[model samples]
Target: MKPVRFQFKLKYLAILALAALLLGNRGFRSLVRNYREYSRLKSEKAQLEQQRVDLEKKLAEISKKPAIEQAARTELGLIRPDETEYRFPAPKESDK
Candidate 1:
């Protein structure tokens, strides 16, 4: 009876060693790190782009005189001389 033995090819071992060496290299590690940073930056850019679009829409709305007047009257408690502003108190929680 003969026992089975595993035989590894020298060329395969050399290829595996080369791969491991490359993976252990600082340059390769830095490349991986830089790629991750680039991905993060891309995500941040998307968020900033969305924010910019929202701000542009707000700016466009505020550019109109009616929108500006409405915002001012509601936000700043402003009133025109010919208009009468009414005051009301919030209803009590118990009353609800």
Candidate 2:
């Protein structure tokens, strides 16, 4: 009778230990997932910072008067003072 009672207690303790181990394992997996997401967001933030710096440098360059004038002339086809301006009339549509 004594040996049977001891065996029952041992089996109960083993079951409790297994449940605790499984809970701990699940907690460890969740921690790993959170850490990976944190690292990915940090790297993306660094990339965005680099892009911002590059844009700021370009903005500084384009703030110059000469650069602004050159861009306007090339993009808008604008002319300086003393330059001749040509205007072409729109062609009329022919009767169908």
Against the hidden reference, what TM-scores do the models get?
0.74, 0.56
The sequence of per-residue lDDT tens digits that candidate 2 reaches over residues 3-53 is: 998999999999989888777787877888999999999999999999999
lDDT of 1 by residue, 1-96 (tens): 433332346567788899898887899889999999999999999999999999999999999999999999989989999999788999999999
Worst 10 residues of 2 by lDDT: 87-96
Point out where model 1 deviates above 4 Å. 1-19, 93-96
In angstroms, give how far residue 17 of model 2 lies from its true place. 10
**Which pairs of residues collide in candidate 2?**
none
lDDT minimum window of 10 residues, candidate 1: 1-10
Regions more than 4 Å wrong, model 2:
1-24, 85-96
Q: What would you estimate as the lDDT of candidate 1?
A: 0.90
Best by lDDT: 2
